[model samples]
Target chain A: MLRHAIALLSGGLFGSGLFISGMTDTAKVQGWLDVFGDWDPTLAFVMGGAMIPMALAWWMRSKRVTALTGEPLPPAPSKEIDTKLIVGSVLFGIGWGLAGLCPGPSIAALSYGGPGLYVFVAAMVTGMAIAPFVRARLDRAVPAE
Target chain B: MPIDWIWGLIGGLLIGTGGAVYLLGNGKIMGASGIIGGLVDGSGLNTKWERILFLLGVAVMPVVLYPLYRDVDTHITDNYWVLIAAGLLVGIGTRIANGCTSGHGVCGMSRLSVRGIVATCCYILAGGLGVILFRHILGVI
Candidate 1:
């Protein structure tokens, strides 16, 4: 029960923050990406701002094996920077730059974004649904990592 | 509009607090893409209720919060096909990379994960390039 509540609260806080910060504003995101065009630096500030507390959390995490709730923290992240990771990030960046809607803002902004958001989100979910099959095929074609 | 650094920082602190909640309470990263992506890819059923509640928390906020900033412009492009392509790409790419902005950029980078740093660099560069190609050269919005 506590865990669930925490997750819910976390999501709520995350959504509220994004909305409050105006990260849901697609124009602002696009502007930040628009280095050649008239650019906006608000997104950079948002990231920098987020980094402060998160870095502190990580510092706390570094010394501990279990989370505050007594659950074991997940293993250390993988160090590999393979082709799949690069290719995937590149693809994601293109889409993000194209639309200026990432998963967080898109999800959080759904209540106010009108009908088109549903279409975008549905297509995104479909792509996610198909990912396991795609991964399986790739695994067969590519050697072990 | 000009940069709004103060709000940006305040909002970011809130976001980080949410992340801290997830890390400390749930022992998980608070990444939107990863949370939902796990469910879609069929690996998150074990925590289905948690994910659902989290999404509900996210999906329900605008009702209460939208009034605060009626002037902000959320310029989701009017072009539908572009929206479709963008959505599909975001889904696949985040899954493939094992993270998106939240997972890699904010959460992972905070932990000093190399993968997160590399992925952030890749996506930021790619995003910048995309803006140049699509917005400048091709004149697409």
Candidate 2:
């Protein structure tokens, strides 16, 4: 029960960061995306600021054994790059350029109450739903490690 | 440019701190991507409440804050098709990469996973390309 509360609070704080960072605002994000026009480099600073906690969290976890849950936190797994990665990256770039939205921001935007966010979230969920099947089919065509 | 750095710092701290607590308390990595993905999988009854609440919190935050911080505008000017495409692409990317920015950039990076390091590099590269392609190559700017 307490664990669940902590998770929710953590997620809330993360979402709040996205909201406060102007990341949830499409225009601000689009401005960042518009590197050639105004070339708003502000998002870089936002990203840099955001990474601070991430770095600290990593450091803490790496040195520690048992977490607050009394369970050992394992190190992350490693994997090689493959075709799915390349193709998915290209598609992600195209989408990001076009919509000026990423997963965190898109999910964060839902709180703002807009039709676009709704559509975007729906599409995002649909894509997530379809990914496993697509990956399976692709994997069969080209066995990867 | 419009954002207040102090607010961002505070928010980041809270997020990081809370994430750490959750990690310590639950033995779970605070990765939003994995949580959301797990929710979709319908794993078990024990996790349902927490999953629903977490998602609800994510969805309700903006609405909760809109009244308090009325200065910022949430309006958008982009075309619908573009936004839809972008969302779909991000979904695919998250799956293919085995994680999203939250997973790789936040949780994975925190654990010092080599894959996290590589994935984050790819995320930044993709983001940079996205900025250049949209603003320069396409002249959307």
Candidate 3:
């Protein structure tokens, strides 16, 4: 119960942060990305500011074996840089540039209705659904290390 | 009105704190893509309820603040083709990469993960190229 509550609060905070920071606004996101055009630097500050607490959290993780909820800390992600990471990020970036919505903002912007919103999300989900198969093919060709 | 950097900073603090809470209390990385993506891909079945609850919180916050944020607009393109194409790329890209802005940008960078940093660079560069191609060159989106 406590774990669930904490998850809820964390997610709520994240969602609220996205909303308050104007991340839910696709224009703002596109504006930030539009450096050659009229760029908005607000997202830089958001990214910078967001790193503060998270950096501290990592420090805390280094010192503690267990979490506040008494759960063991999850393992850190692998350090290997691979083709999938680069290609996938590039693909994702193109989408983000085109639509100005990443995973978090896309989900957070759910209530902020627009016809394009649902369509974008549905297509995103479909892409996700098909990713495993695509990945399998890619792996067969060039085996991810 | 254009958003101020001050609000971005403030909201960023909240976002960071939220990540901290999830990390320190829940003992997990709060990658939005991975959280929801895993559920869709069937890898997160063991933690289904937790994922759902977290998503509920994410989805509900706007409604809770709807009174204050009544005029919020995403300004996304009305073109269905653009929307679908963009969405598909985002979905496939993030999944194949194994992270997104939240996972790689926020969580991974904070910890100085090499993969996170590399992925971030790749995406930002590609995004810039994409903007140039789609918006400036082709004038599609």
At residue A38, candidate 2 shows an lDDT of: 67
lDDT of 1 by residue, A1-145 (tens): 8888988898898888888888888888889999899898988888988888888888888788888678888788899877778888999999999999899999988887877788789878987887667667766777566
| lDDT of candidate 2 at residue A60, scale 0 to 100 | 75
Model 1 chain B poorest ten-residue lDDT run: B66-75
Candidate 1 per-residue lDDT over residues B1-141, each given as its tens digit: 454777888888888888988897889998899899988877998998889888888877756787767555677888899889989999988888888999899999988899999999999999999999999999887
Model 3 regions more than 4 Å off = B1-3
lDDT of 3 at B96: 95
- lDDT for predicted candidate 2 compared with the true structure: 0.65
Estimate, for each residue in B8-98, the C-alpha lDDT of model 3 and write its tens digit: 9988998899899999998999898898889889989898887888888888897788678545878889889998999999999999999
- Taken in order, the candidates have interface RMSDs of 1.1, 2.7, 1.0
lDDT of 2 at B20: 61
Candidate 3, A26-90: lDDT as tens digits? 88788888888889888898899899999999999999999998999978778788788888999
- For DockQ, the strongest prediction is 3
Worst 10 residues of 1 chain A by lDDT: A136-145
Candidate 2 C-alpha lDDT tens digits along A1-145: 7756766776677677777666666666667666556655555556566567666766777678877656677546655667776666566656665666767667777756478778877877777777777778879988975
Order the numbered candidates by TM-score, best leading: 3, 1, 2
The full ranking of all candidates by lDDT, starting with the best, is 3, 1, 2
